[model samples]
Target chain A: MAQQEFDTTAFRNALGSFTTGVTIITATAPDGTPVGLTANSFNSVSLDPPMVLWSLAKTSLSVEAFNEAKHWNVHVLSQEQQDLSNTFASRGENKFAGIDLEEGLSDAPLIPDCSARFQCRNMVTHDGGDHLIYIGEVLNFDQQDLPPLVFQQGQYAMTARKPWEGVELSSEPKAPECSYNEDLLGYLLGRSHFQMLFRMRKVFDEQAHEDSHFFALSVLNIQANLSLEEINDYIEYTGHSLTDTDIEFLISQELIEKLDDETYQLTANGRETSLLHIAQAKAIEEELIRDLGQGDVMALKLLLKRLISKTDPGLPDLWKAKETAK
Target chain B: MAQQEFDTTAFRNALGSFTTGVTIITATAPDGTPVGLTANSFNSVSLDPPMVLWSLAKTSLSVEAFNEAKHWNVHVLSQEQQDLSNTFASRGENKFAGIDLEEGLSDAPLIPDCSARFQCRNMVTHDGGDHLIYIGEVLNFDQQDLPPLVFQQGQYAMTARKPWEGVELSSEPKAPECSYNEDLLGYLLGRSHFQMLFRMRKVFDEQAHEDSHFFALSVLNIQANLSLEEINDYIEYTGHSLTDTDIEFLISQELIEKLDDETYQLTANGRETSLLHIAQAKAIEEELIRDLGQGDVMALKLLLKRLISKTDPGLPDLWKAKETAK
Candidate 1:
């Protein structure tokens, strides 16, 4: 039988939904020539004594260099560093060409204009599918004052603060003029995944037993901008039941409006109703984060990262071993 | 202590370092009227039997309605639904005025045109700082294919794809036309909290010893776009080290250029140098994702979702009890 082929594009697209930053993993070849490649797969391993990890494909040109090199460097890029992300990402390019070079405390060529730079000795390497995972111990580092870059949806992008809350705190003296007066209210009203169980309790709420339409409305509202087919596909994924008549009923009521023949949007009335719930929801989130603190937050982040990586066809075996060990 | 007067701007900005989406949570008052507010602290909870949770201020007018209400609805707004999010989030002024509504399956008025919706019963509420966290058990849900509206930098926006992949897959059918391009690269490239430990590996590459200046150069490149004050702040936060001259040396090299002396961006040459090692770092990511099968993938997502909620402050004790049972 022909080898089972995987749809790389599908995998990429699915993973692309997750956002990450770009970094350059660098090591020296046996002959002392620097070898490196771009990566966004870097993450932290521990805080005490400071440890970090990144991955490298077994078939990559620099694989041998990474395997034998006793030390490595990871450069975190700034928001304005797309050119660097591109240069290192491309294969066979004179990665070092036209770039001025300087050495770090550990003797690696320091990346000019990076958001942050870390120097470390190769701690260990583990086997991941089609790649070798490298862990490092920190020796020294450099820092810069710049917004970090983010990668998502198959492109390099800048991170935006979610309106009123997430902007740089220092910029508060000059808060941007905001007209979206009810921003906080909207957050409280938006329905989230957990609401599924709540809809069930509505059975006890009514004078006459009725199936809750909150989910239905929210589903339709959520699916508003999608085409009918896309909406259906999403409905199928989320396991919602809506007859064509039900959809047409929503349309007739002017709760939803067609953006295009294929796409639809929520009417003004639709948004107000939805916003009512999302506000309360947000207050809950803030409470959780504040209560959890850093330890739980870090654990949560690590577990979530592992979960996302598992979805990809290319997970590391050692990580699996670690999980199994647990 | 005089209520511990706090700088609202400072507190708001400091917390903005974390990113989240905007949402609105709503519930019918005992009188059968609606109440709502906006928030960004919304997240998914249980996937099995789908559940979602959000928080509300304990002192808000909606608190009474929320406490008495047997069920509530959550609406996830789409990017275009910001107006809707705004409407339900506002105070008084008859939110229902000028709003269109469709009766939900449970006879509650459903907001039209949201990204998604969920109807659930109010299962539990917890006391949190200045807020009441409520967890709803989701019984019904809706989803759409539209991009969610993003609130970032005090503006309404849509998510832009991250960089580092090809725009198109094999010219096969069913592929979505990629909306991302280099022109939008500036919007995509930098919003990551790269682990300090991971960054250290890049700082101590063996090559850094060969060229002491390289590490400094890389750090300076990143700093070019940032103010000196900002750089110092970041270093303090991350515990990184560098001297004033190291910064000066980078400026002298012209590799890191300042834009209008207010912000800095890496020169093309600077980017090239930075990319040298980054490409190799991502190879492991590709490999790991490729190795995992679909089952492992699903399990990973579920586990992560559960773990993430565990850290949430808004989760009801009942739901947490259920999670522990698993």
Candidate 2:
């Protein structure tokens, strides 16, 4: 790791270990052309003087315009701006052609819907190896509630914030020798799934429906007019199969009707019940988004989807379009 | 937000929206006293020169020590070093009493087991409002595989890195008007849980055991001796209650034996089976840790625990200490 014999790729990889927020620094050229590029080098330098700093590669095409510009704006991008980040990161022409800009303290482009923004006047420029560091005094700044996008290890990321104190499931820690503990991924996933279902159980209990009956109704709601055997293929992974008695019970409750001796479809009452389940599930999710921040919930869903894809056992696709003839 | 009359709290909050990796900057005083403090303002400034910068409040107690020091070390804290971060953050005595220092290129007190470490020579100190910015030229640096600790919006956080492309569960985009999609948190959780269990089912199938029998055995393994009602109390949330028929089936398989025809305990074969399940679960988890990075899996577990705690329905604790007399 000698400074004189530094390996460029290794150094970049080591530097990438330090995570940073994504930002797009924008400046206006002498001809009134808006130039912007994605950078994660932005950092707050001072508070009382309201200063910030960011470095740019000397070889960048926008370097000359940025050097001549008197003012520039830093937009801390939100998670929703990944596409915009990619566009500005490349040598795309007319980057701001379709963008609607907001008025700011300077002539620099002010992009809307950012987590934070800093309008600054260039105060000084310092030599930093192959890059030039631009220090500025912030003239005005604003913030929004959107979650900032993060970059780490050369990939985009999102943060699942740990509370200041910490999140504890039990009042006391589990015994060390216990075979199963709260830390087990299996236990955590099962508990989360069942607890969510527990809330929906109250709704189903009103109609004297068991868990298997609910599963059957949910399947019918998606791909209608399916035989009992076909519906079971989609739910066999759940370890609960509907018996003939369970189908008969659902028919007795007016939740399903026989299209033929083998095929079945949801009745009007059954469709209403299934829709109620979906609505309740959405309501519970809304509460979660409120409890946990939207970004954390999004990360959770992303990881869960990945897990599902990795562990899938060749189950039939639940959302695939059914045959029109059927 | 005028710079002259800026509200300090709001400004600080706005700056915090720019996420950063946590670092502990350390240097030795004239009398050889080790001083360090947590700072999130660390950022890389150059690659060719291998330079980095961080700012410290001018009013800090270690200001004089740092000002006089010719060299300092920057430690990028890992997720496992949260306690060390807190200790250095406070004005505590003997912050380095128990820490094991690693030899570095400079005399700066280098801490061991950090995600990354940079031994730097103090290049320049710039006036930054009420703070002093230290720009250091790195002489040598090293990095580990540990996940870096993150700070965002005034709270500690962990990151779940998204792949370069993205995570898409389905092959095609879902219909806009569909009632249920892969985006549903409930559906994701259930699918994730069942899919994980589906893999474990292959192991269980070798023994001709059903999912409900496995659940019952899991409960019996923990509590040793339990009546059928007691076991059902723990397994009911799973929507699988143990019945007399289930107990008879287990007896027929020689997996369990009845004590006074009421209390039930696992036979030697049953204990072996339960232990095998635990090992299989752990192996599956290891594969997940490989597929999803360890940090992302950790974040998923944290979010799941929070979700379970929020939605808990007062189920009896399975790991509670049982009465020895009983």
Candidate 3:
């Protein structure tokens, strides 16, 4: 623990293990200069007194401005404000240039569309070694339903909350020796995906349509006139492929029709079916967001996208390959 | 923002919008008593001078103990430390009971298995209205790769990092008019599940087994002597069921055998094959853990489990239903 052994990079990295919400602290200095910087050190201090605190590096360019400012505003950035965070984090000229300011109790600049806003009067400053800690008495504050942007280990993040009671698919504890217990990631993904489709199965089942037909129509809804082979190339990952009999069935039902040159395209009836499926899918997701909260669903989708990309197996780009060619 | 209009609950809710990592600050009173409590106010202030700060309410039972202490330790809780957080958060007697303590450079009790630990010398203290803010100079620190626990909007959470460049399923932007775009949660979940299974298809394909056989054997691995109807009850959610022909095929391959009462059980060969599939599945998951980092994968699994529980359409518990009956 000697000073010589203090690897500053490693120390900073260790400190980064603490995750935080991104915030933009804004203040209007003397002589009418508006200044702001992005900081994640913000934390709530005293609820009774309604106070909050954050720190700034002593060597920051706006140190004097913050020190002399009578009031400051802390805006917890939303997920869509990453660019604003970057703009304020850097020494960009005119950090507040494009951002629309909302009027607040103090003269401090208030940026709109933050997850939360705290208008505070600068109360006291404390020495924090190479940084200065500013404790502020919160004059007024407001919050919105926007998902707050997160930072963890120097990377931006979103959170999926764990219910205090925990999520258990079964009311019973799984046997300790079972290898195929419920904790498997692959198993969970498969079940989650299938259960979702299982719900939508009712909608398609009522129309006497199999999942393969739904999958093909979905592909055709985006990229028209695909031969059976080309359509199979996209939906084969679902372990189902469209057969000629299935195509005949679709055509008889007027959901799809044969095109010249041996390709098939979705008819107006088919397009309507695909859109209905999409609407049903959207409804399911809306229900999920309502149940799990928007932030949790956004985090789930982000992770799913990342997982899909990481494990992509060179699947054909369903949109890019077809759209750009046209 | 008048005094009467300051709703304490609303103000606290606004403050909760900002996420933070859970921490437990520990110190020993001069009279040989150890004290610690759960906190989320910990934040790093200075990198060069190695300073950090956390605050405690003056009315807290341990506030005087902390104020009188000359040294303290900050342990950033990992995902596994949720129980520890709850333990410290409560007014339980003998908070350190049954917990192992690690030796540190100072008298403060150091906690083990945390995401990170900072041993610090209590340097300066400032009055923050109803709270006392303690700024400390970090003396020693260490970190592990454990996923840190998060607290957001009054719920415990885990973070999934968003890359600097966002995760895009396709190389190009999807057409605005396409209802079949990739952003749909159902689509993402389906694609991710299929792609992962697509990779595992190699292992099972080598044995000339289909995904349906794979799913059936998986259920049989957990519950023995299940009739086709009972087994289908467990796996029909996967949209693939074991047909009578498929069951006969498994019997011919010696992976399963028919019982006198029309139930089926995995033979020795079937058991071996199922175990291999489980191994391959675990290997695939390990690769994902490597690629997505441990935290992100954990978050994904947590969310998936939650979604599965939320959307469960009364699928029979593969383990519990049969085991309890047995």
The candidate scoring highest on lDDT is 3
lDDT of 3 by residue, A1-326 (tens): 45636789999899899999999999998979899999999999998788999999999999999999999999999998999999999997888887778888989999999999999999888887788889999999989999999999999999999998998876677756448888888899999999999989988998898889989999998788788999999999988899999999999999999987788998998889899999999899999999888999999999999999899888888886565353
TM-score of each: 0.31, 0.95, 0.97
Worst 10 residues of 1 chain B by lDDT: B184-193
Note the residue pairs that clash in candidate 3: none
Best by TM-score: 3
lDDT of 1 by residue, A1-326 (tens): 12223444443443333334578877678897877788866654433344556666667888887888888888877666777777888886568787676676555566777766667788676554455656676566555645555554455544422333322212123312231111111111111122322332333223221122333444444334555554544333222345666557666766566675566666786555444333333343345446433222222333233323333233122111112222
lDDT of all predictions, in order shown?
0.48, 0.87, 0.91
Roughly what TM-score does model 3 have, to 2 decimal places?
0.97
Give lDDT tens digits, candidate 3, residues B173-211.
776744778889999999999998998899899878888
Model 2 misses residue A27 by how many Å?
Answer: 1.8
Off by over 4 Å in 2: A1-3, A260-262, A323-326, B1-4, B259-262, B323-326
Kindly give the stretch of ten consecutive residues in candidate 3 chain A with the minimal lDDT sum.
Answer: A317-326
Model 2 / residue A71 / CA error / Å: 2.0
Alpha-carbon lDDT of model 1:
0.48
Per-residue accuracy of model 2 over A59-148 as CA lDDT, tens digit each? 999999999999999999999998899999999899987789999988999999999998899988887777888889888889999989
